[model samples]
Target chain A: MEPELATPFRERAGRALDDRFLQEALTVATTKFITLRREAFAELPEGDALRDQARAIKEATLQRLDYWLERLIERIESRGGHVHYATSADEARRVVLDIARRTGARMAVKSKSMATEEIHLNDALQAAGVTPVETDLGEYIIQLAHERPSHIIAPAIHKTKGQVAELFARELGRETEPDPEVLTRIARAELRQKFLDADLGISGANFAVAETGTVVLVTNEGNGRMVTSLPRVHVAVMGVEKVIPSMTDLAVFLAILAKSATGQKLSVYTSLVNGPRRGGEPEGPEELHLVLLDNGRVRQIAGPLREALNCLRCGACLNVCPVYRQIGGHAYGYTYPGPIGILLTAMLNGPAAVKDLAHASSLCGACMDACPVRIDIPKMLIELRREVDQQGIAPWPERAVFGAFAWLLQRPRLYRLSARLGRLLQRPFVRGGRIRWLPGLFGEWTRTRDLPAVARRTFHERWAALEREARR
Target chain B: MTTKAEFFDRIRAEMARTPGRAPSALAARPVRPREGLDVLRRELSERWRENLDRFQHELERVGGVLHRVAEAGEVPDVVAQIAAERGMHRVVTWPRDTLGVDVAAPLVTRGFDAAVMPGTEVAAAERARLRGLAAAADLGVTGAEVAIAETGTLVVVSGAGRPRSTSLLPACHVAVFERDVLVESLVQMGLVLEAWHEGAEPSWRGAAINFITGPSRTADIELTLTRGVHGPKEVHAVFVERGLSVARRA
Candidate 1:
């Protein structure tokens, strides 16, 4: 588990709300992303249809996932590449470390891959005597400060340029102005040398094609190219669910992925790597390794979170989520953040891990609309909440209160009798038609929010009076 | 470590648990991709003019400069003009037979340090030296294998003479192409991809393929869009109207 989870979720959210800079940055970044995504879809007439097709393709691939995976493995092995199967995150880390040891790799350069982050690979690499370098501009900044990413695509969205400048000064001992251009130039120079010198390149595959034995990576920065091309050994870590059937299916996904992520028709670079370098190629990795990580995804095949396997990791849901727009990603306290992040967290960790996070959403359904494949995140979140309640993961007092409310709701005669008794008993607490505070354990509910006072006459009583007047 | 058999067994067991699923199908692939590609090339030949116009507009929208030449020989002039404007001297390029134009000799005559990659394998030391030159060069020149008008993307397949870094590692990249390589949209590009992988790969072809839409850019820090983060800062496409003189190899 992440160390940040030690703090209660309420305190973490309270801290995020109190941070003035975080609030401003979250508002600006998410609002801009939302507008860009809207305009991008508006320009394409067949955007909605393409989204549906992408979703169907994902579902079709899942139905026969084992067959596709077998074919993918066969193709990769045919091309002189190695494939590793890791059932858990620990096993995944061990597979990569063993590769690093066999290759005698001293330093490793990485592109932006959330899979690596999900497994906490950097700490493992460090423990194994391999230095890992992050090449993406945002990833580099957060790595310098030893902080986790706050946003998926824009990893450094929570940071201001001034803070970035300070980080560089303190970490790298290089002082510069707080400008994105200058900062980017600094990172390019620093990472360029690492790319050439590093023995291994690690990355995450956006989609792996089973028909052609291809692993595809999409990035706006050219680091993906450098990582795959310059290193002597290339290692790509991908979840089993990321595989698709054919190159034709890849086209459908490529059409809508970037448009939803950053509103670009296509990112700057979409690299398709087929195993290791072939003969006569001037430059490419001599050795290629692909790690297929299950990491709790296999169980979801028959579980309630089956629809979430279709996620493209485009992060459009994050931009449009009302809860995400307010508190930002750090409050989620997991590798992934926002609406889909909650479901993915519950998938990776069980429902008990998201006992509080399942209620993070307002059930607004904006995430559903913004999702490229439309994963129905709110529906899954509701299901997770039910599971949490049924599993007894929620606190006992909260469950007891809900249980009592359910009983009262079922018995209308007892409910009305209790209401009349409470109306007479609540004379001391009633003020201005609002119950501001309760004396006992019920005060927990009204402490943060107000409850409306019961009416002088209940709805049933009012209906009876109207009927009598009509009869008269 | 989990063995392959165990992984497959786990997956199969889970898959068996869910007996019913919604009926769905993948996109229909062309039965004869190579023949389909030939037919597509013939159809695109008729609409080359309109496709070129759309390509220019989209390319420019994505921050790329497009230059038109009546003949392949004039491509060097555009490359020279771009270099002169930037005051760049070091240039790296793909081989003449693969790129369809001989820009190195002309650029060398114009007082630029031009390096052309060989069409065959070289020693490891020579390879490293060549890579150093690419990393230090100021401009890179190559040919686009497929140019898509819909998204203004250039598909470059790495091969013997066509090193991937020739278009990367440099601040400015200039690609020379003709009408024969133009496609209308990503769907057509998909068909082209299917055709390329249909049979045994050509001997000269390598393992990596890239679809570059524009110059490398990032908006990671404070959401400010900055170009030239890692790849080329400037991208220029030179179009030959009379078609390339070299015979098509693919």
Candidate 2:
């Protein structure tokens, strides 16, 4: 759950690859998501233009974020909802804890919120004496197992039903069968009580509409509705970049969000909460708080990774990514994990944090195509790689190798001499037109992949010989 | 903690650094959403039947059941039949004034324990009791504010007699609506939302407006689709062809 940070990224990815069950699960889930999204987009004639409009809206909002956020605060306050600004993850945790402390909250039920996971809110809530309950089925499973979500949308995809059955039997003392239907029924009965009893409901906003002072939550399991409606107090934590202009803008986003996520036209429930309970409402939360989080997003407004701010967190990018398909989300070792995750990790934690992750993608550009907002993830990743190199965060061996290659490329004579020398040095290693392995530190590269053998005659030498023959 | 002023100041500082990143603009909003909605609704009225057909097609495609009736009086019978099929005895619903039909009396006559939500705010103890009833009930019937035909969505706004849990807490949820509530697409739904927030909000309107596309579902367990994880498993929409007497929003 703490990101398994002790292990290196390559080792983590190796572990995932060796796991037969995880391999099967990842392949099945991601492939299904890919097919569903393709079918969804294929049906909608206006999807491409909507994607462009959504991206433009995100960029335009960032340009005037201060104005829009000010308007949002005014509208929310007018409707009796409170807004809190947190500059860092620690401050965000404190803000939520203070609200919980002041409101006399004991039990808190949560919908699936990646922002909360990023801030590590569950530990804080527990340390402060309030019991935090994850109500989403996938989230609840992982929470009980003391694990983090493997996928954004499907958190428990890595666990087979038998594993979940064992988890539930151990955690809840309910001896349930391994059938998904039975396991789901048990979860429904178990979480229904928590939804009713919990005094606090915390969620992550998919998008916050500034003009209407509305917090829109799109969910398929309907937990978002329950969390916002049942609890006496509701708190929504969101990144500062999620604030959109108006309901019209929200429509454009909604059109593609679920389609990109799971290929549903709309997630089962999209709850737009203006504030808390109104005067004559029969049932609703009495108080609402929106915590605007700026973990590391403000700097990216002018930074190289700014395009990543446009990400919708749809996980469509994850499904289509070849690297993610092989390694899975847990291997990335962060709150977000995929092609976009590399950029987002850099955005939240700095480029130095993702020295290896920046190179995780093959730069095939499938993620950009799958993104609802069309965030050029590969472009940002390339920039992140450059930033890492510029910051001297790359390993010394990698830097030295690239530096030597660049130096050689600059001098044609030196490059030719090196190629000729390589022909003599590589005689021991070259076999059947491939270098199976190399000696010393370079052997690490050949361990997982083969290197092409240096030619007997270089391309420049061949071209020079051809020129001489033509002249004759 | 960052104050609002400081947060904005940081953002403004970043904006100053990037002057010509790109010349971009936000989506153009409806200049006069109220007028725009009026004209759009008038145009859509002529094709209301087509929209209804589309709505039903989409709704059924998403695993929601659609029931058509000749009049408002026929809704109770459909509700009763659905309850019988499920062997559900207890029912909760919006009050007659909000639902535009007297389901409680008829459901009771048909030997079901029916409880209608109160129109006015009640004491905390009574609120808890009603919530318990809703949680314990097998069926929940409510009125939809708008139904989008394009996505098979029933939009319900929580208000005076309309509790959010009526459509959420029960295993089986039945929503009754008329032709007036049907819209063609999400864009039209957006216009309706704009118009609702254009002026002072209606005093009775609550905090949440939910768009229910289908029954609550999840594919978290090895990508196996499961329904009613935390909400209703079955969602049925009863359309009254003769329309109800309730005032429709223009």
Candidate 3:
């Protein structure tokens, strides 16, 4: 784990809240995304049914994952492409490194891929004496700043343009105005040379067609096209669940993916690459490799979080999530962020990894509504909470308090007695008729939020008094 | 480090351990994709004018330029006008046989440094030099294999004479297509994709199929939209009303 994660999620979230620029950026970015997504979906009359169809397709694919994967491997190999299976993140890293070593790759141009981030591939590449350059504008900015992406679609959403201008001056040694146009042009000129010089290109597959052995990459900036087309060798890192049944299924996904992510009818470039360069083709990579990454995804096929495999990584849920809107992606302390990110973190790590994270959601169900595939994130989060509790991963104080509350609930006489006692016991802590602060471990809850004071008169007592008055 | 056998074994075991959440089925694939596509094309032929109008509307909405021409020979005039407006001269294009028009010769005649890609594989050094030429060129011209109206996307396939960079590396991209290539929605494009892959792939076909919706764009900096980041800054679609005399590749 990185050192930042060691500070604990609370401190990280506090830090994010204190940063005025980040707060403003998060609000502006998320609100704009929400509006755009709503407008995009509102225009499509069939959007609702398409969401269901997309979900059904994902479920159907997972049901026969082995068949599809085997067929995909056969198709790619027949077209002279290599498919490697990795059971873990470490294994996936080694597989990529081995390929790089054999191909004599000194530098790799990368398109924005969450899969590569999930496996932490860049550091490994750097350690092996191979430079990995991020080509996506947002990703490139974050890479130079030595920061993880704050938002999935807009990785540099947390950075202000002024900050970016400063970053460029400091890192690239090129000073320019804080204009997006100028900054983008500068990046284009710098990365264009890398694309031409790099021997290897790496990308993530948005969807891989088992029918045609095609790896699909969607990007608004067209970096996906450059990384796949310009290099001598192209390697695509993909989660095992990314494969769809055929080209027909691909259309269903493409219809909603961009609208859900960035509100574009379609991203500027959607590259459907089938293996490598064919015999008579004038341009394309001579060698193509597809890394089928398991990395904790395979276990979820039949496990509790199986529905999460349906995620398209569109980042819609992130924009709509209340917790995410406030604290942003970094506070999540993981590769993914927002509502879906929590589930993904738990999926990649174990249930223990999300002990506090599981309680992060407000159970508003906005994420499910925003989700293109409707993965039921909140339901799975509740399940994870149960798992955490059962495994004794949650703090003992929390477990004991909840246990005592449950016991008291079953006994009405004791419950009523405790309520009367609690009202009197809470007098000192109660301010403005709310529990603003509490002492000891109980202060943890009150520090960030307030709790309503126990009603002065119990509901049962009020009911009895009302009945007596009615009889009189 | 896990072998393919071990991977399959693990997946198969997981599958046997539990049934899926619910009974589900995949979206129905076209049974006879080639026949379906032909039927779609015939149906579209009568209503192509409406489709083209929609394509123009959507294309412009997404920051692309649409030019309508009476014949294939008129394409170069549009290309020249665009170049003149932008003050751009150097042009790289797909070969005449592949692009279905002779734009290079006319472009050169009009004082543009136009270079047409070779129709067959070239040696490594020559290929590298051609790539450099593409990288430095101001304009790229290619033929659209499928023009989707719903999203204003021009699908271009890279093959023997058609390199992917022709549509990618240049600052501006212009694609020529006929009414027959226009489809109303992504669903129809899916059928076309299935049809293209239904039979054995053509010998000339490369490994890539690109859906170019508009000029490249990004909103990474403070969510400010910027165009032509890495790909073309301008994307122009030239529609030839009278079909090209040369046949399109399968």
Candidate 4:
């Protein structure tokens, strides 16, 4: 059964933190991944230079994203591929559905593409009578378990091998062990024939080169290639921001994306598919359709938030994110998770809708270090919190207290009085020089984490004592 | 009818409006952006290998096989054995002079279907025939314009002698490459691809550009590593002993 997702991210992250196993697992998985990724980067020559190069390339592309997207649509169509423009998820879904219906697609195999997940392609396909099969191992496991991805890259990072084995046996209707290799073998055998039988293959593009009218797919498993190549018809769903000016530009982003995502210098298969094969060529989709989704990206592109488009969905930010490392991707309540998720959710769902998402982070700079594209996430979160506060969307008591405190902070006498009053109020709860428990509104703060007692003396008192010592 | 050409024209117009071309990152390395077949081929190989070697290990670990071939001469025999052992009889490859009719003739003599094609000839009938060929054949062999030694990546550039589908539509892709095609890093590869388009039409003759490191694979169905999900299930490389592969220096 799915847990409650209607609550705000704060409550969800709080609940997740309260679950000791989740916190431990997230820490273990992300830390190991971060270590592996770091080692991989370390092996590269002047790795920092590469990161800067990746960042510069992405930023340059984002700067002219609008123009590039237009070119991409044009190029795709020129190669006998159909291009559709979707302004919203609903539109993208409707278009995909119309295509599915037209194709008479009853079953579809998909790769681990976040954009498709963002639009909830599986849910849409299932609703339309086309059963969607996830081909990425992590995504497939989560699908079988009836769960969403916990990590951006490793979707089922939250689940143990043992849990996967049990889910497979129950869902696949075959006995299987939890061994990682065995699990992989089992999944391979089941999906191999599905590739040959499927009518259409759907994929998400990492980079769509306008120069060549090509969709660049990077993957560790060959599934990404198959999903695009095997079926008679191919449907690609991509955000407009994924475009680059030319194939030459593809080389820049490709260099850093794999290293940052999973410590892979590059994925095993990086297929650059331009339109469908022509003339006497064999084994490629007869018809190719490229779906360019604007969703909320266009709105954020020109503003101060345009930097968000620079994200490559590498999940490096997710691995190092203190908040994401705790509650995982599902808690973000958006397709993207972690630092990127926090920013994207705010932009996609609006700040008022995801006010709690900003406060979910600890604002530690770990994510910044891991971000290959160098998205200044902590600054973005703080800016978002300020936006939320300015919108007056915060809880009443919190708002009221801050409003009064703002006035008091402006006056010296009132500030002193409030400080003394605050000390007296806390005096009753002081025990063994620590405040072990708190009351009422503050109770949630100390439920699992300790709240420190205020200092016994204020700065004024400490200053006076120093003055007296100086006199002596 | 909206032919692919008109569609591409609109796309070209769109690209013309983008913030122009991106500045190279290797700006400090003295921007001697190398063009020509040798330099472009070199750059493509460099970038391809860097990406391939980095990801191919996981594919191998999961079940795919990755090999490095030193020469083109070793290709036919190696390909023949792979098909024979795997029970593959029919074969397809890009129509290139280097890959040669004689190379595939051995397999044909052994009674396997053998054919070479340019990637641009893909149509409904062609795709159907290719699928039929793949179903009946054991291996689909092609040659890469550039091969990355760092990652063992095979870069297929489609043109008159090469067909994009030959590399991707096959159940297995066996590439025969020279040792000289290898590059040390992606930076060099970036230069190559850039120069490949330095002056020509953006779309050029090739419609599809692919970088394949291993067999077609996926883990999505149930988080299992399944091979041949969309493309070839196996990727084999043939490197000649006394041919052209160059390793990068520090």
Candidate 5:
């Protein structure tokens, strides 16, 4: 039986906030990336114009995704590349494992790809008796702890230098200091051999072009390039929505992804390959495969969640999310943490299974506004919250309050009276008319900050008085 | 066939639901640029530069060399020097010229396995042959249709005359560019691309359009910089002074 790969929002949040070092590390790291990305965007000189084009390009590509995917599959197949359409995480793993078995894979190295993490490909490989090695520095650290990522862009954002020093001392089989530079050195020395020794490479798509049947990978570190080239066989696991109609489509994403991710105009390496190496190339994989995972994306594409598909995986939303700011990624308890994760988990895992994820957001529009492609994440959260409400999955006290409020709302006079009484009722708990400590149920809101105070008078009463005064 | 085979066969039959049309199948689809193409071009140009700078820093981190050239006329000579210094042969590949292929006289004279025959279709077999031909060749070269100075990335659109692998499957990738072809950013370039994609058939299959920022590099091993772990370890770009006036601008 699979040990539950779940962390209830409350449980995860409790563990996260308990660690002061993790909190500090997240603060320092997120701040640096946020600052760097902002500076880079501002430095472009031609930045604003590029953002518009990149936006248009991504939107245009998305509109014609179906058309492009057909063309892409043909081109890839024609180029001797094999493609598999997987409908779920299990299917994705099955296809990749089948390929590994066919190639007799002994070892595999991987770059950082959200889709791979979402599908938990590493575990599947380990299950199949292949040693799966993470080549990304942050990913390597988490892999050592047999833990999941705590942040979108920086996986080890929750780990302080001291904690990492301890982890390395125990995991790397050596004594190490907590110094940032020293820890980075230890991590570097370990990943080199994995790249050379790995027999197969797996990566995720940044962009897939239908016109050329090419997959694009842009990265700050060149690990993505190594994972694709060094191995005899290479497999790219992508979500179906990643397909774009043309090579030109990338121009748009290229703009927003950098600004939204690291505030750069571009990443360090943007490698586009249509198929495996053909001739005298001294290196590069001999065979290439792409597994397009649908999971639940196809349903999302034709539904209200289509806006979610517009996500470029820039991590900008994660940077600005107030809820994410407080609790961080791991608190969401899934691979995709933050505003995106809340909605994604609801759809992908279904509301009943991951209901706790719904309350994880404060409905702050920071994430939506920060999004380069403009996904209305706040609206999605509200919709999911409504689902939670309907399922009666919300807290018992809140559900009862809402139930009574619903009864009162049906009668205007009662509703007005209820509002007046509610304000009076909440006064004792309020300090300076603002609730500093809630008695029960709403404790999460009051745990760290005061809840907003309600006005003494209802708007309807004020409006009625204004009408009578006008007549006089 | 076994039970699993039967299941897959049944799945295939079901998925054969809509028989796919040719790559150009979408030719009849309305050409509605959901978002303005010109607007997209302007946005991408800035993005290109931003992407280029990021690409450059990444390459540098991995101990790769990044040289920004100012002209295209000097491309061949620069490429020749790089190859010669590396003890690669005098043979070099060139990106497509709208008017004609750009194989120099000295290169044509070489008795290699096979070179991109100047005026032939860049068919798959032909591409495979060139890969075979380029293994021992001094250098593999191609001209970048679009060069983004922001990211220092060279965009090569492979079509009938150009083979996709020529730019990537070589010992050293030599990309030639004209100063004018170098766009300030990706946003500005999207204007022309929108038009280029205007009547593009969905079934129209083109070779890969590789956007290479710098030499292939990896910082995977504990963030230690390693060059040429995979792909082309060395990438040399020559900025030719003269731009091709005949090539159709997107």
Candidate 6:
């Protein structure tokens, strides 16, 4: 389930910044991830070319998304598998519920899937009287804690080993030492039974090959293999944009995904499922279903955020994002978080949902550099800000300040007159060369940071002065 | 309750509206993947020693153990040594024809409980019983379909004799492969995948293909890396100098 969205983005971010443990964890995790990614790319000679090729593959696939999806459906059905199309999150939930009910599945084991998180499937499953157990260790921890994931890959990074030990003690009734190794052992023993007993397995597709009808899952733990293999019924939910052209294109993406995410040459396990079990196979699911989800993704195809569809959900952008590094994921108050999350939140919900989130970034372009596909995140963010302002969704005071500023900039005489007047108006607030406090709406900016007072002589005035000296 | 046609129609409508998208093309697929793979294999075979050296360096880098043997016949001894060091007795393995080695009989002679998976399909009840055996086993032995050098990855395809759990489930997984299975990069692996899916798949091909890079690991708990969270704690790759006599899948 998602956290409370009632809290505005600033209050949420402020609360996150106040949490001492979260601040330390975010700094350590993001710094470590950034360093690892840098070293990984330094070793790969063909990384740049692969990134471009991967981006192109995503664009090409989106241009013919309908054709690729049709082919994917045809191939999956031909392979003795089922394909479900979900136009909305509610529809996707219903489709999954119907499968669980028909299959008589009381419990479903899941690999870590952002798509399921995006749809908030766990709550729906619980409401349907079927237990959905998250098998990924990070996801399992958060699920047990009755909280949402704070990070995309490292979901429980916000929680210390001490908290996890306490969680296990309270939930699993196992009192253990605060040690990752011991805790992981306990989780393994506990979840192993769930994998063997669960009648249904649900996963998300990292990449679905349209040419071969293969759903690829990348995970460090082998839970993905366990879930897909042990369960009688297997369901994979994928965003419509995840489909690719061929295995060759998959290779291009694979070459760079892990490097950007965790700096590993490859994740520990990359499982490719070509539908349900074939004849003579000793162990595998009897039925396979691929759920194609288009929850607000279709609108973005022609929308301003079209390039964002190329995201691999690697979370590389999050690690490099200054805002995300400071406030962490929970503050974003959305399933997706970070610079990419702001765009994704807008994509999923609406421009109104991200009116505040759109201003979260400083537009430093670190996210663009860290992105595996090199998505122009800052550029699209600027566009989203424009859309939010144009739609009249932005707060009136924010609009008034920016709108007044824009109006003043267009008229040279008014601008110069205001510049002279601004110096007089700022006299009271300016103390020791900075405006440490302000009144009204502008006070929010100075609450945490000191703003430099307007220059003694503006750049335009300085240029004019220089021209006069040259003439003399 | 959205139908497939309706879902596709919406996608098509959106796509039609985005006419000014920059012209782009997908990564160029192999024109003739089968021939391309064959040529690449031949090239790799000559420099397999270098590939194996690189594979060992990377495998060790990622916390995987690698052992080298002079011939395929010496593999069981290596497996025995690994088992002895770990004080493990129960072992599960893929069938002899699939693994290109007959380690079950050799292990049984040495007083180890070695269970070999069936080469043909069994009843559902029997399948459940075999799964129980795999789950209880201490060590799992299998054959590698493709040994990727670039990332030190072992690609295993599930099939009739090759149960996926033999390389999973167990605490330690040991895969035996010859030089023939070696590929230099993910690019070559891509070509191999294309070749495998060129035409009609074989009847015995299972539903899943797994690429195991190292022991199952997670860094989720406060970013502290922990091994064998859900799968093998240790993964070993034994390279055979003289290739196995089994029929290799193209």
TM-score of chain A considered alone, across all candidate predictions: 0.95, 0.97, 0.96, 0.92, 0.92, 0.98
Q: Write the per-residue lDDT of candidate 4 for residues B1-250, one digit (tens) a residue.
A: 2333443354444445444443433223214444344555555555654555643554354344655555545566777788888877678765445354345566677777787553344556665665555544556776665655445466776544455556665667787655455555455565556555455433324445566666665443323455665467677766554543322100
Worst 10 residues of 2 chain A by lDDT: A1-10
Per-residue C-alpha lDDT of model 6 across residues A1-472, encoded as one tens digit per residue: 3555878788899899999999999999999999999999999999999998898899999988888988888889999999999999999999999999999999999999999999999999999999999999999999999998888888987999999999999999999999999999999999999999999999998999999999999999999999989999999999999999899999999999999999998999999999898899999999999999999999999999999999999999999999999999999999999999999999999899899999999999999999999999999999999999999999999999999999998999999988889888999999999999999878889998999998899989999999999999
Q: Is the docking of candidate 3 incorrect, acceptable, medium or high quality?
A: high
In order, the B-chain TM-scores come to 0.97, 0.96, 0.97, 0.66, 0.62, 0.98
- List the candidate 5 regions with Cα displacement exceeding 4 Å: A1-7, A43-64, A162-169, A174-189, A280-282, A423-430, A438-454, B1-147, B154-183, B187-250
Interface RMSD of each: 0.9, 1.1, 0.8, 6.8, 9.1, 0.8
Task: Assign candidate 6 its CAPRI class.
Answer: high
lDDT of 6 at A394: 97
| lDDT tens digits by residue: candidate 5, A1-472 | 1123454558778877887765665666566667867787676666665555555555555555655677888888977898887877888899899999999999999988889898889989999999998877778878987888867667777766677788889988868776665666565557655766688999999888786677888765557766776577999999877887764556656766867776655665676776875542334577999887777766654454656876778888887776677677766767788888777766677766456767677787878777776678988877877877898878787688878878988999888877888898897787787888886667867987887787766789899999999999
- Over A1-472, each residue of candidate 1 has an lDDT whose tens digit, in order, gives 7977989887888899999999999999999998888888998999998988888899899999999999999999999989999999999999999999999999999999999999999999999999999999999999998999988899999999999999999988889999999998888888889998999999999999998899999988899999999989999999999999998889989989999999998899999999898888898999999999999899999888989999999899999998898888889999999999999999999899899999899999999999999888999999998999999998898789888989998999999998898889878888899888898798977877788888899988899999999999
User: Candidate 6 regions off by >4 Å?
Assistant: none
The number of the candidate with the highest DockQ is 6
For model 5, residues B1-250, the per-residue Cα lDDT tens digits are 1233342343344334423321211111224553555454456555654545554555454334545554344444565567667877635354344322344643444432225433344444554455456444546777666666556666766543455445544557776655445555565454435445555422222423455666554432222344443346577655443443325432
Superposed by TM-score, candidate 2 places the C-alpha of residue A269 at a distance from the truth, in angstroms, of 0.5
User: How much lDDT does candidate 2 score?
Assistant: 0.91
lDDT of 4 by residue, A1-472 (tens): 1244577667777688787767777887788778878888887777787678767767666655556666777777777899887767888888888888998888888877988888878888898899899888788888888888877888887777788788888998878777766777777668767877898899999988786688988887777767876787889999877887765567767777888886766777787787875543445677898887767776665444567777888889998876777787777767777888888877777787657777778898888888887888888888888888899887777678778888888998878777778788998888877777898878767776776676778887799899999999
TM-score of 6: 0.99
DockQ of each two-chain model = 0.81, 0.83, 0.86, 0.27, 0.12, 0.88
User: How would the candidate models be sorted by DockQ, starting from the highest?
Assistant: 6, 3, 2, 1, 4, 5
Candidate 2 - CAPRI tier?
high
Candidate 1 ranges beyond 4 A from true positions: A419-444, A447-472, B246-250
lDDT of all predictions: 0.91, 0.91, 0.93, 0.70, 0.65, 0.93
Task: Please tell me what DockQ candidate 6 reaches.
Answer: 0.88
Better by lDDT, candidate 3 or 1 = 3
